[model samples]
Target chain A: MQDQVRSNVVEILTQAIPSLESKDSFALAALSDRAIELAAVFHDEDALGIALVTYAFGKLVSRGGEEKPLAPMILLLQTAVNALSSDDNSAYKKSIQRLTRHIQMVDNKINLYFQEILEKARIKKGSKLFESGFSIAAVASLLGISQWELARYVGNTTVQETQPLHTLSVGKRLKIARGLFT
Target chain B: MKTLVFDSGPIISLTGNNLLWILEPLRDAFHGTFLIPRSVYYEIVEHPLVMKRFKFEAYQVRQQLEIGVLTLIDDAKVAKLGDELLLLANNIFSSRGQPLRICQRGEMEALAVSILKNASAVVMDERITRTVVEQPASLQKILRHRFHNAISMNATAAQKIVTTCKNISIIRSVELATIAYERGLLDKYLSRKSSAEERSSLLDSVLWAVKLHGAAVSEDEINEILRIEK
Candidate 1:
C-alpha cells in the first residue's frame, strides 16, 4: 500500500475503534467519510475496503445490533491496525478480511444489509467520482457499477447545472448541427 | 464525408429517453456516418447486454448498429491517441500531488476517432469531457468546488488538450432532440389541432425527457431553446 494510504488507514482504524466501543454512530459516519476520501483519492481496493467496512459498521451501529457480535470485529480492527503499524502487510490484509467476514457471519439479515450498503456505497462514490470530473464510463468502470445506475444517479444531481455553458450558444450549436445534416 | 463521433453519455441519454430512433432520420438526412468507437460500443451495448435491467436497451442500441444507423470504428491509431489523450486529460488537474483522472477510454476513444476523422462534431452529454476540451479554466473551478481542496492545473497539459480539441464541436442529446423537432421529424407527435402552444409543449416535453434521462442540459437552456423556437 502507498504510504499516504497506509497512514490514513491507520488513523481511521484508530479513530474507529473508540467510536465502535462507545457505539457512537456519528463517529462512524466521520470515519466513513474519511475512508471514502481515501478511496476517492487512491482509487484502490484497499481504500474501498476500508470505506465499505467503515460504512457497514456505521449502519450496523445505527441499527443497534447486539454488542457481543461486534466485540470480536473490534479485536480484528485492532489487529489490522497493529499489523499496519508493524508493516506486516499480509497480516493487515488478513485482519481486514476477517473483520469483513465477522460482520457477514453475524447474521443473514446483517449479511443482506451489508450487501445493500455495499451497492449503495459504490453508486454514491461513483457519482462523486463523476462529479470530480471523471467520465461516467470511467467512474462506472472504476467502481464496478453499471453505467445505467451511474447515469440515473448523475441525472438527479446539480453537477450539470453548476457547469459553465458551452462556449457556443445553443442556437449556434443547433445551426452547426443543422448545417451538418443538410 | 461529414461525420459525428458519439460518446457513451449521449447514447445512454438517447436510449433511456427512447429517442434513439431520431438518429436514423437524422443520419439519413445528414448523408454522413455516425461513428462510435469500439470501446464505446462495449460500454453502451456489450457491457450492458448481460445485465438484466438494461439488456433490452442494449438490444435496442445493437439493432441500430445492425441497421447501420451507427457504425463501429476500431483502429490502433485511434486507440493510441486515445490513451495519450486520456493520460493528458487525467493529469491536467490535481488535488495535492496526485493527478486526478477525469477521462476514460470510452470517451477518449470517441474523441480520438473524431480528431482523426475530422468529424463535424462530437455528440456527448457529459459536462466534464465537454468542459475539459472547451474551457479548462471553468473545469478547474468546478473541481475546486466539488473536491473542496486546493485544485491545481498543469497549464502545459491543459493547453495541449485544448489546442488539440479546438476544432471539435460538441452537442448533447438535448440538441439532437431539438434538431429533430426543427426538422419536422418529431411532427408525428403533433395532434391534428396542433397549435403554437402545442408545438411549444411538444418541444418542452422532448427537451425535459432528454434532461431527465441524463442529457447534461439545464432547464434554462431548455427554456432558451423554447424561446428561440417561438
Candidate 2:
C-alpha cells in the first residue's frame, strides 16, 4: 500500500473504532464517506475493503444490530488499525477479510443487504470518479462496474450541465461533422 | 485514408440505445474507416463477452467489428504513446500531495490512435476525456468542485497533453445520430408519409435516447439542436 493510503486507512479506522462502540450513526456515516473518498482517490483494494466494512457497519448500526454481535466487528477493526500502525500488510489484509466475513455471518438478512450496499457503493464511487474527470470506461474498469451502469448514473447527474462547454459552438461542430460525413 | 477513431463510451452509448446499426450506414456515407483501439475492444466486447448481463451488447459490437463497420488498431507505437498519455493525464491533477489517477488506457489508447492517424475526430461521449483534450482549465475547475479540496495541477503536463492533442476534434454519438438524421438515413424508421412534426419527434427521441444511454449531452443542447434543425 502507498504511504498515503496507509495513513488514510489508519486515520479512518481510528475514528471508526470509537464510532462503532457507541453505535454513532452520524460519525459512522462520515467515516464511511471518508473511506469512500480514500477508495476513490487511491483506487486501492485496501481502501476499498475499508470502505465496504465501514458501510456494512453503518448499516448494522442503523438497523439496530445488538451490542454483542457488534463487539467482535469492532475488535476486528481495531486489529486492522493495529496492523496498519505496525506496518504489517499481511495482518491488515487478514483483519479486513475477517471483518467482512464477520459482517456476513452476523445475519443472513444483513448479508444480503451488504451485497446490495457493496454494489451501490461501487456505482456511486464509480460515478464520482467519472465526475472527477476519469473516463467512463476507466471508472467502470476501476470499480468493476459496467459502462451501462456508470453511463446511466452519470446521465441522471448534472455532469453534462456542469461541464464547461467546448469553445466551439454546437453549430460549428455540426457543420464540421456534416462536412466530414458528406 | 479518411478515418475517425472511437473511444468505448460512444460505442456503448450507441449500442445501449439500439442504434449500433446506424454506424454502418454512417461509415458508408463517410467513405472512411471507423477505428477502435485494442483496449476499447476489450472494454466493449472481449471483457463483456464473459459477463452474462452485457454479453448481448458485446456481441452486437463484435458483429460490427466482424462485418468491417469497425476496425481495431493495436500496435506498439499506439500502445507506447497511450501509456505515455495515460501517465501524463493521471498525473495532471493532485490533491493532498498525491497525484490522482484519473484516466484509463482505453480512452488514452483511442486518443493516441487519433493523434497518430491524424483522424478527423474522436467519437466519444464521456465528458472527462473530452475536457482533457479540449479544455484543461475546465477539468481543473471540475476536480476542484468534485473534491472541494486544495486541487493543484501540473501545468507542464497539462500543456503537453493540450499541445499533443490540439488538432483532434471530438464528436459524440448524439452528433452521429444527428448527422444520420440529416442524411435521411434514419428516414427508414419514419412512416412513408411522415410530416414535419414526426421528423421533429424522431430527432428529439434519438437525441434524448443517446443522452439517457450515456452520451454527455445536455437537455439544452438537445433543444438547441432541435431549434437549429427547425
Winning candidate number (lDDT)? 1
DockQ for all models: 0.61, 0.61
| Candidate no. 1 TM-score | 0.92
Candidate 1 scores an iRMS of 1.6
Chain A (candidate 2) TM-score to true chain A: 0.84
| C-alpha lDDT of all candidate models, in order | 0.85, 0.84
- Give the per-residue lDDT digits (tens) of candidate 2, residues A1-182: 99988998899999998989988877887787777677667778788777767776776688787887889888998999999999999999999889888876777877787788777767776666677667787788777777867887777777777765565577877877888786
* Tens-digit lDDT string for candidate 1 (A1-182): 99989999999999999989888888987787777767766777787788778877887788887878888989999999999999999999999998888877778887888788777767777776777667787788777877777887888777767655555678887777777777
Name the top TM-score candidate. 1
Q: After superposition, how far is residue A56 of candidate 1 from its true place, in Å?
A: 3.1
TM-score per candidate, in order? Answer: 0.92, 0.92
Per-residue lDDT of candidate 1, residues B1-230 (tens digit): 88999998888888888788999999998899999999988888898888887989999999999999999998999999999999989889998799887778888888899999999999988777787888877777777876779999999999999999889988888888888999998898999889999999999998888787777877778888999899
